[model samples]
Target: MMQRTISTTKHWIVIVLMSVLGCGLLIQGGYMQAKAHFAQFLIERAFEQTLVDNQPHKPWSWADTHPVAKMRVLQQQTDGFQPLGSDLYVLAGASGRNLAFGPGLMLGGAGLGEQGNTIIAGHRDSHFMRLQYVKLGDIIELYSTEGERVLYQITATEVVHETDMKVLAPTAEKHLTLITCYPFDQLSGNAEYRYIVEAKPIDAQPLYS
Candidate 1:
């Protein structure tokens, strides 16, 4: 009888510990979701101001990154073209910290809507999640702070090792390369592979033209 009582007590203790752990996980998840939404709101406001003045605007006073461009994807619909999702504000500098808020323009890449390959990187589960559903021939539209809009058609999508730097190489012709970790459904962080989406301008003319 005593052994059974002791076992019962231990089981209750285990259950209580698990309950606490589950609640903690839920709280952390809620906090992260709230932060993500709030950050996007601030980023959107800063992007709008940048568009109005044609200057970079920091999403927050202490943020190290600023809005550089606004990007959105479009897919063909029965009626006409429709946005795949809401616009994502592209930040400057593809540092990991900067990418937490939105996609970041990688260094050594061409300027937005410029003649060389422009590279952007984002977290797979966050801002770039829509990329997984994108297919060849979809349209990627980028709006620069200078009031210029460029349309790029998705030409290729491939998965490559994370160490492969070829994707970041400058292209002779204008193109856009988007990078995100592969296997979006993975529960682990820091995947070894990367998913790349290559796009080219629909028109060869200068952006301002």
Candidate 2:
């Protein structure tokens, strides 16, 4: 009958709509899960790479997974804190992730505590994502491969635009800057602002190479 045909058509349309919505949700969940996993992987790697070996070497590559550097005498919450060497800190996003969002290479500056400001950058999802949890006076540590250890303390935190160059400038006294995505809880994946952690160098060792 004509009535039966119309009912069947409506049922099919409803089924198709449900299917489409389900598919969309699945895709979105997958993307968010992937971002979270990548973030976790980054922190763990930093811990193993910098904590276990504090001093990082020149021309250090993310591909080079071995102990290219080492750190000594960590400060702050040493257990959870993964101190980046001055080598990788200056290089600036060497791991295909713009911890700094610029074209410059990662960790290009010298690795030490005597510099003006050892600026370090990492990706929000792939590196330094835990920076969101950091508080004032949090300790930062670094160790070198040639038997050197350095320590820093978080003095303050700030949020700035991506193009703000003052965040990376050198200061009159030795300092360390940790930068990552601002509003770390954003779900839209748009990095609008940057979180800056200002710290001062407490320990320094002369270059032994």
Stretches of candidate 2 exceeding 4 Å from the true structure: 1-110, 187-189, 203-209
The TM-score leader among the candidates is 1
lDDT of 1 at 9: 100
**Backbone clashes, each candidate:** 0, 20
User: What's the TM-score of each model vs. the native?
Assistant: 0.87, 0.55
Q: Which candidate number has the best lDDT?
A: 1
lDDT of 2: 0.55
lDDT of 1 by residue, 61-172 (tens): 9998898888988886666568888888888999978877789999789999788999999888778888999989888999988879899999999999988999999888
The Cα RMSD in angstroms, rounded to one decimal, for candidate 1 relative to the true structure is 3.6
